[model samples]
Target: MHDVIGLVLAAGAGRRLRPYTDELPKALIPVDGDTTILDIALANLAASDLREVAVVVGYKSNAVEERREALERRHGVRLTLVHNDKAEVWNNAYSLWTAREVMSEGALLVNGDTVHPVSVEQTLLQYRQQEGSEDIVLALDTAKVLAEEEMKVVTDERGHMRRITKLMDPSEASGEYIGATLIEGAAVPALAEALQATFERDPQLYYEDGYQELVNRGGTVGTAPIAAGTSWVEVDDHRDLERARTIACRY
Candidate 1:
């Protein structure tokens, strides 16, 4: 429990979700009761004691801004808004790069579309405190069944992440990233450079590509495997949204 900032990437339009996102961004979509995906994210961060948070917003950002004061009061955290004007055209690499200054102190980043228990955040913090650990730690779901839609990861024998992307073969992946990561202070510059390169190469690049950039620069990014029986879902489409609702209420 050192001082850490919670960084959330909530800029995507979630086009695949279509009509559900016709007026609202995916983060505002209700999954359990009336709670939103971003609500769960904020609650989890607050529960984990990461009380200061920065949210990168785009694609109907007013939806999130409108509730900013209430969400801050409810979660017991100071919330900062970072805007990504290219959220619609560029990928999350740029969205993440937008928070470079706020996250320079240290950050725990979670994608806004994911729904998981607070234990996921807890496990990540615990791992970060371990000896010989670095600033970058990815929350991995090694026990879960893999699928094409999930962001896949491959690690070396020593457990450092070797690859993180959805384009890899499922059979080649060691686990799924689950969109939660501890980006330590030491990783700030490398991550920033990587994210910049990723966005410059193509606006459609994922922030995970930034992690790969850090690796290419010889940065060590650890992986924290979620415990067995821990449930989570990343809502990208109608079917995924249904799964989120099913598991969310149980949380």
Candidate 2:
């Protein structure tokens, strides 16, 4: 097994989630009681036995900084804060790129705003340990109904990703990429380069575009389907926040 750390991308401004996001980043929004979205993310990572974590912060980074000690004490993990100065102006491609150094050792990557169980992390790690596993593996939700907002995936017969983008038609998608990925140490250099290219091509491009760049270069990206009926939600709006509250307490 590789020495993997938990990596979280929590730098988005999340403009659509205003008021809640006016003073804090989207990751700081409370979904269940006092447990913020980032808290669930850190808790899940800690439960997966990842003691070291790197969180990319921006868009009111001070809020996260202030809670750093409390979060570390609560989760029992040492955190390294990676600052993304461009997080407010650019999209997540640059935010992800900011953590390239930490990611070099390999990482179980999760979006900070996603509320999911520890099982999602376990699934990705288990798949990565199997024979013939790809260097990059994504946790996919095949049972969910796809929509334009979902980051959809199209895979070939062998389960290698053929396409990953939000622009694709939902009917053609194999599943939704649920903002979780396992990146092996061997894939770091290429992924960093790909992320650079993606952000340079368009500052507003997503980190998923970096995945597409790798796919276009003939890299194999594998997938692990999340167990059917498992509850998860990516809180992008008040409606999604309400859904998160409903499912998160169960986790």
Candidate 3:
């Protein structure tokens, strides 16, 4: 198993998941009887032996911090809390950049809003088995096409992702890029470079822009095919929340 440090990006405004998120941070929105979305994410990480979790918080920052602190206290997992002040002006990519200083090599970048039915241990294991082949190993669901609001990844026949686009047209999408990804330490410098250029060129763009830039520059972004037909839900709207709740109960 990789000595992975998990960076959970919980700093989004989550405008899409309004009403519920209108008052509290998205990570705190309850998914079930007691577990919040972020709670599930942390539990998943803990199960995979990735105990160290750093959460990046922005909107409703206090609420996020309190929730994280409580979870840390109860679970006894070591968690580092990070804050982003510019979340109102920037997309999630900026929230990610804010945590780059704390990011460790072979880090698992997890989106706080995502809840997966599958274990990330399998994904991490695949990444470890691949050895020195690529820098970023994305967990991909090859059969599903995500919605327009979701990030899309287009991989070649060799399972090498050639392009990643935030705004995708159905005619162009190949698969849904899941929220969890394993990034090798070697890939960090290039990712940082791409992000720097992106901020200079279009500071308003999402972090996916940087990933796309990496692909455009011929960076090695590999794809690991994850549990086919497995359920993976992104809680972005009320419907999504209901769907996540339904799936959460069953899973």
Judging by lDDT, tell me the better candidate of 1 and 3: 1
Worst 10 residues of 2 by lDDT: 125-134
Across 41-120, the per-residue lDDT of candidate 1 in tens digits comes to: 99999999899999999999999999999999988989999999999888899999999999988999999999999999
Clashing pairs in 2: none
* Candidate 2, residue 198: how far the Cα is off, in Å: 0.6
Between prediction 2 and prediction 3, the one with superior lDDT is 2
Q: In model 1, which regions exceed 4 Å deviation? A: none
The model with the greatest TM-score is: 2
lDDT of each candidate versus the true structure: 0.91, 0.94, 0.77
- In model 3, the number of clashes is 0
Q: Write the per-residue lDDT of candidate 2 for residues 5-113, one digit (tens) a residue.
A: 9999999888889989999999999988999999999999999999899999999999999999999999999999999998889999999999999889899999998
lDDT of 2 at 192: 92
Q: For candidate 1, what is the lDDT?
A: 0.91
Q: Kindly list the per-residue Cα lDDT of model 3 for residues 198-231, writing each as its tens digit.
A: 7668768767778888888878788777777777
Ranking by TM-score: 2, 1, 3
In candidate 2, stretches whose alpha carbon ends up further than 4 angstroms from where it belongs are none
